[model samples]
Target: MQGTVDSTPVVTGHEVAAHEEHQDLRVLGLITFLASEFLMFAGFFAVFLVFRGSHVQWPPEETEVELLLPAVNTLILVSSSWVINLGTKAIKKNDLAGMRKWFGITAAMGAIFLAGQVYEYMNLGYGLKTNLFSNCFYLTTGFHGAHVFIGLVLILGVLWRSRRANHYNDITHTGPEMAEIYWHFVDVVWIVLFSLIYLLTLI
Candidate 1:
């Protein structure tokens, strides 16, 4: 008696290799984009350092940048970076629920940091046109805040997609991976910004 064959197709090694190659290309493209972004920020940093070096008083008399709120925000972002990594680890283990939890925490942290930034702005007792330092300070922090907002949106988009069936698994988690990378970039940029604009200037 001839046995019946299952006839179901399985994913081939070549297909897996091709998918990995595509993912690598996507990551490479993201890195190139981030490099350009870093260059732009570098330009702003140079301008800020030049202004700070030239002026006797870094922030001037009228501008007052407090340390408490920005320090808290920095802590929130730095911790969120770790949380997003946990999400990455979860997805690598094929744990969808775990990934969602960690990413949700990260998004909440990002929201809190943004709210803190807004509160800081309201109480800062200065404006963009106040002086050279104020202008540089606002421009640099505002640009970084915009990136944070974008990162939040990206995270939310990934969460929404994760609700779909089989949208992401251990082998097919590129969306979350890319979002994590962007979030990490945003966090790193803030660390640099905090060190320069807040820590060095205020304390």
Candidate 2:
């Protein structure tokens, strides 16, 4: 029997190879960028430590800055990182529903943490210009809050895109994964900031 048979789909080898190469380049670029960010933050931490050690009485003797609020915010941020990890894991498993739910929770927690920061600022007796302690506290925690805001934006973008394009699959979930990486970094920074700036008050 004479029959015309089409053996394969029409995608060219060059196209497939190009796509893989592009993905590899993207991952490498992200890692490089994050490394640079870590170095910059490390310098800030060094400065903070020097100034913190020089001060005999932190926040001065007259000012009253409660340590409990920032500690609570630290816990919230850390828990949000766990939620984000769950979302990323779900996306890798091709569980879109779970990913959305967990990501939403993570976003909410992050928002709550930011709100707590604002509340703490309101309650802080001294403004950023008042003293070295106030300046350092504001600089470190404010920088961390900005990072949290950016992370929330990234999470929202992924959630919207995942819904629109159904883009996250077992083989392609880099967006959520990268977002989780960034979120975890933010959480870790807060842990250090909280311990250095807040918990140290106890000792």
Tell me the tens digit of each residue's lDDT in model 2 across 1-203.
Answer: 34868656555787785665433456566677878877766777788788868877765776656777877877888888889999988988889999999999999999999999899899776788987777777888888889899989999998888886679987888888888888987887788877787777777
Which regions in candidate 1 have their CA more than 4 angstroms from the true location? 1-24
Give the range where candidate 1 is weakest over 10 consecutive residues by summed lDDT.
17-26
The residue-level lDDT of candidate 2 at 49 comes to 83
Compared to the true structure, candidate 1 yields what TM-score?
0.88
- Top candidate on TM-score is 1
lDDT of 1 at 8: 55
On a 0 to 100 scale, what is the lDDT of residue 55 in model 2? 79
Pairs of residues at least 3 apart in sequence or in different chains that clash in candidate 2: none
lDDT of 1 by residue, 1-203 (tens): 26988755565676775665423477778878998998888899989989889989888878868898788889899999999999989999999999999999999999999999999888988888988988999999999999999999999999999999879899989889999999999998998888888888755
